[model samples]
Target: MHKEGKVVPLAAATDRGARTPLPCLPVLLLQVRDKAALQLRQGLQALFDNADDTLFEMADKAADRFDQHLYFEAMRDLRLKRKSIERGFLDIFYDTFARIGQVDPLGFMAANEPSRNKAQMERAASVEGMVARVLSRDGLALDQLSLRLQTLLECTLAPQHNPLGPAALSGYFLQAGRNLGVGLRVKLILLKLFERYVLRDIDVLYGEANQLLAAAGVLAELPPAPRRRAEDRRNDSRRISATLEPDDIGADSVGQAFFASIQGLLAPARGRIAPRLHAVATAQPIGTADLLRLLSHLQHYVPAAQEEDDFDLGQQLEQLLLRVSVRSGTRRRIATADEDMINLVGLLFDHIHADDNLPHSLRTLIVRLHIPLLKVALLDKGLFSRASHPARRLLNEIGAAAIGWETGSEGLRDSLHLRVERIIQRLLNDFTEDASLFAELLEDFLAFSQDERRRNELLEQRTRDAEEGRVRALQARQQVQQALNQRLRGRVLPQVVVQMLVQSWSQVLLLAWLKQGEGSPAWRNALATMDTLLASILPQRDPQALLQHVPGLLKALREGLASVALDSTATRDFFQQLELLHLRACAGAEGPAEVAEVLVAEDIVLAIAEESACAPLRQPDEHAAQLRAVQRLRIGAWVEVLDDDEPLRCKLVARVDSSDRLVFANRTGLKVREWTAQGLAQALRLGEVRLLDDGLLFERALESVLDGLRQQQVH
Candidate 1:
């Protein structure tokens, strides 16, 4: 049997709780003891006698202590990063060289002659040279690249020197000498450079490397290089090609082939990029110095992260995105990445996409917090959440994807740059009317919040203001259109037709007023007369036989609005004749009388009778009547695509006629059979459209437009 312990009543549980008499030490004895304890902190008995003063002195000391402690914590971070980069860079160097089989790359560098090595040495020497070639073909300037490369190499090779100056290239190698291969024995290097030079950024380093390759005579045009647009062709309106000194064909060509094979070695972090400092002697003849050069880049970049004021970076990124969007007619260079920035950006992937809701000015400041973060700005689909914000989660994304949890590699980097360029262009073109929505939201937040309150009085006032603002904006657009229509409608009939054709196109809104034949009487007469004419008719009568006069009326109004020569009397007679002819097209398939009622409502009665309108497409068999059938023609002949309602519904495509009749195709892979361009021309019923063949060679067209602009000289 388990027995429970007895519990006393709360009042009597403890002698003290029951208010038992206390047994205490003598006051004098206690005082003496307190004094001793206070002295140790500076003595208790006197301390008990003067406790307040002592406590005040100690508080000041504690505050001083914390300030110093904070400094040390910051110092600790700097040391950790310095060490991580130092170690990683050296290891990368050694591994990169060792695998390449450089027997004594370090020693080879010391010896000026062609050192004895495998066939790969000749190839390894040419690596930088070839990479330059490939990049130039993609578009890069090489003259400035050489200096950057030389700087990086010097810093790595001699870490004891002032790396920020000319000695940086050598210092880089010396810092990672062990990894450079057997024979590098440099001491006092890391300490010297750390105290000495500032390193180059990753973009400058890679950019330099690419330049070296291009200078070595390697850039080659690839088959898929976008068809060289003549307007964009490597020609200048008033400039000449710079003199180019070609490299030895035999040496450079062989080098390019070898370098291409080894390009795989540079793929880092995703696939394997062995520590460049570890360039070991092998059949491939890679050098230890070469290894040092490679890892120097890593040392220059890795472990460059630090905590930052995040708010500033977001705004800066947004501003830059806007800048990129508005720039036109020029190619912009995209940076590969800076070493530290890429990691920082990788760390903050989710943050970049997170809704920071910062003020516009502050957004730019936050973006400067991390450069890499900006790389992802506007790239993400505005999707991110609380769970994804953790640092560890972002790091995981980096490890999984070459470019921040998505596909991007060296190959992809170039493509991403191209895509970025297109997105910028598209945005500028599409967003002409609306300024950034995000920008507007931040600016209007206070008023928006006030307007949204549920209180009826405030709500009604805000709603009235908003409605007024919208009405004013719409009125402004209508005013602009009226002015534009008046100017265009008075001249250029073909252009006028394009502008005023009532259809699905953007410019159709201008057609309403123009449909009246530029006269008030014509619209009123047609409206009244047509209403009575359509009052009675059979539902199933054929539509074709009744519309003989309708097309001519539309023709006259079009000509009149354009201020072109036209027979006004004939135009009136045609519409007067069509008063009884049109059947409403919008009326249901049930037939003619309902069609006539809808026709009066459509307000097209006058246009149909006045205009000899061309429709968009025709029957396939009509090809014979439209054109004399040809036996054969070369590929690439321009032909119009066929449709039945509007010529606009028809367009141009490449065509060739063979023994079989006609063949048509477009560059985008559109192919057509059993229809011909001639058939399309005849089929157009209401929209008169025409094709201008090859439509002016690109350069000529541009020059014709731009050459007339007087160059404004700024002093």
Candidate 2:
């Protein structure tokens, strides 16, 4: 059967097979009306199943709708009905009338009046006439004046398309007229009444209903009813008209009866959400998924204008839902931090949204902070309730400062976002129970943001100072290196000794040089002394003997610095570093204790060549000495193989043969020579060769050579 524009399939039909098939439209209409009325009663009974006396009284008045004017008059007579009808049942009545081709009866009535613009003015004149008549009498009841004024305001402000019409203006005058005879207190009372009833917008009234339901933990249960198609409603109207004569059934009665029926349909469905939510919130534990579902249901009620104060109340309930809906493994009780975070978020949400004065761009930026704020709350529950907490104050300060922020300031907005993100990251990484841990950092950041010009000036100054300091340190380092190199010229030294001196003393020399002015004579003398001492130390034939000189060199370094007139503070620091280096080198040696003891006991070790008087005390077997020399060879160690001509300084590149013979490379790791350890030892015994411990100097020098070899092999 075609109901609305679409054909009603048998399965989709709301009512079917309830009675015998009928050919007559009137009989079918009677049956449908009886069924609809029965359903309506059932719906009403279910709706008021748990209702209180006040709700029952409301339901009783609401069910009486046989006569249209009488229903309105009955409602007007009841004080509670006036308030409750507007908030609760007015929408329902509008829906019923709209379904039957009437759109906003009150609006239609005012619009259809003769002289539409002057209708409210005429009404106000009539009300003023009555009020004036009452006042002229020797004794006049204040109630009469109050009632007349209220009627005038309602007529003036009653939901009209043109609220600025003459009627509304006259109503305003009538309201002010109440104070003519009454004292100031009664005037205030009349003003409050007008504001409370006449001036209140319908949206606010609906929001209040939503808020109350939310507070009672039943908002999720009462989802908005599904609207029927206009065509289907027209068909229903046609059926009602066909079934009953105009005198037999009034349109007002049908509408009132239809409202009761809707209540029944809504009752069964409304209970579903509230019971489930109550069960989860209070009865049993809920998982994240369940909580998310509940949030989904409640999200329908969260008004789009979330910046409003009442919207925050909804958010608070959402946060509470999240708090109670703990994941498994949690302690079950909500944390103090969580409560603090919820409260803080609520405050920020209200503050940002309520501030319509803020620039749109800045308001947008602040609104984006909600997610991060929520994350912080979830991670650390203590953020919710604390007023003076650092994180809490920081967020509040950001919002407060952002209010005066201008549009087009992307840099400032980005910086603020970055700072908030950084704080969030810190909270996530280090979840401290104490809120004061971030106090200093937050305070400094807040101070930095508060003063714009000073902050920029300070930042620029620091940047310039940092660059200057870097250049100064670099120049000092170069000067120290140049002085050492100049003093070491023409002095024959082992490559290993030169490299070690450079590695250990480079930083120390740079620091010492930095302490004095450029080209200072005293600093030059210190560098010259250091160079002479390093050049005098000869390469020991024994690698172990080379290790023994480290402690003595460290000691001489301290003495030389103390004797020189340099910055004492810088000198002491450099000396301490050298001492630490000595300890590390000694530890690396792993040699006999006698070697360390000898180095410690002797304040100085004189440079002794291999050909000196102490050279040949007791020579080991030639083969054994050669084996010892081969054993001491490290892959990257530098060595000198003495020929009849000039000596060759080369790095030990690789072991070519399994015996003591090895391949040697120059500083670039390119094969320069290859020979047995026995040949090198013989040269060493003859004072023509020496082993050099140059540390990683040769290894770094061979980087390019190794890369070249790798490329060649790849080809």
Candidate 3:
């Protein structure tokens, strides 16, 4: 029992001398158990009936274990079955437990003892305290008190090694009934007292503890509390500021104080600004009423500043306006439509009302522009009131354009705002003298918009034309190269000479072939001259002399083509190609003195044999071809060298130059090596090197060296 606001341990109550066994103790125990079982059965049947499969399963499982008196097993099965049912079923289950608790309080307390011994003891003390408080006026009998204390101890202090079995309360009642020497009537009255007080106390304590846990968000057994209204949520969100300490301000204290002061100053105009500010804060679109209210409040600022000189009202008002202006500038950058324009103004007022992030100095400068802006709106409400209004559009455009204005640069920020102010001033000045200025402004804006569209259209057309011309020129080059390759087939010539002819003269061929029979008389005559020059370079002619004529022949071809009126850009491109090819051919010819390696300027040869014919438009599998070519290169194999900026020339690999460089001999038999092994490997990978088998040629050379070595040995 609990006394003097403290829980007196059950051990203290049990210290009293033991009582003799009570007569008919067995009958009393049977009566309490029967009553409890009857109440539990009636409650479960009424609640479930034929409805719940989980309840039916529990009944079946418990009935099978009835021979063993496994009431604890029945309760465990009930817990398991309850998990599979709807959440609403828990209410009926707890109610049934409550009804059973009324029939046998001690037994009910034991059965529901918390799984943890510590928690069960704490709960027993709490229930004991409640019972003591309720029955303080009517003291309990010693025997009754002793019985209740024993029951509480049995339920709470029971060793929890296997709590899943029958309640320890049963053992306590059995031992007490055997020990106590009281009659059946006295024992039955004590049992009634246990049911009335201790059981009722347990229910009250359980309910209170559950409520506390649920309120603290620790218990999920109960339903959640109702949600707060929207207004309440907003208030709760803002409540943190009330508890903010001075130390919390830190470096941003000035900004915070300035905002607070602005809000205080604007309290007088709250009637006009509050509704508009709320709409903006909630992200709602602004309407005409909001705009009109904003303009009225802005008008009050100027007069208030003029009258309150001592208060520095003008400077404060200026600071407020500057803050609004800066925010408006930010909003303008993202505004896409008319609603955005209206929203911009609403947001500006909201910032001013809240004094959000505004610096003191900027706020002053901003105040100066307010009167001019307001006057323009008064002159033509469309200026600030409507999104599509020309004035509104102009301001938005200026704001967007000024987004990138750097404040660190000298006068840049000032210049941007000045330009905005000048526009406002112009509108105010013109509206006072001539209302027609609005019409002129609208007309000028439309004209500027029209001009921008035209410029964009022109740019797009030019881009398209250039792309088409590029594609056409590529097609023409491909067609001419294919035709020339076809025409040169089956001719025997040096490979270098053949390559030179194709690279240097492909452009001339393209022009002549494209203009043939399609141009004027002059172009036709030029084409004839080009064909004649091309025909003179046959494989039967001296290859060296024909190669020498290449430069002079190319110059004549260009002059003749120029005589025909061709597209200037096309003609320029053709000559550029010719120049590049000429430079490369000249470099190759001048580098080596071997006439066998050079071909005459007029000589045109088809070096590709029948077994290894070159397909003009057919691209080879470069990677596979290069790998095969690399495999064919023996110690003294002859090969034609290919480079990005140099013309083709024959070479012999002298030896491996270095780890990363390759050595080769020029056509004159001179060492002219400067190739990197990695670069050579890449060229080989791209199939740039062409293998020329000269095994027999090298065999004879080797034989001569062997004979010379034998003679030296004889000497």
**TM-score for candidate 2, residues paired by index:** 0.18
Better by TM-score, candidate 2 or 1: 2
Give the Cα error of residue 714 in candidate 3, in Å.
Answer: 99
- Tens digits of per-residue lDDT for model 3 on 182-210? 33323332233232323322222223333
Among these predicted structures, which one has the highest lDDT? Answer: 2
Reference-based lDDT, residue 394, model 3: 51
Sorted on TM-score, best first, the list reads 3, 2, 1
Worst 10 residues of 1 by lDDT: 237-246
Candidate with best TM-score: 3
What TM-score goes with each of the models? 0.15, 0.18, 0.24
Question: Each model's C-alpha lDDT?
Answer: 0.29, 0.40, 0.37
| lDDT (10s digit) by residue, model 2, range 6-110 | 132332232332233322222222232333323223323322221222222223345455433333333233333333322232233223211222223234224
RMSD in order of candidates: 38.1, 39.7, 41.4
Error of 1 at 122 (Å): 28
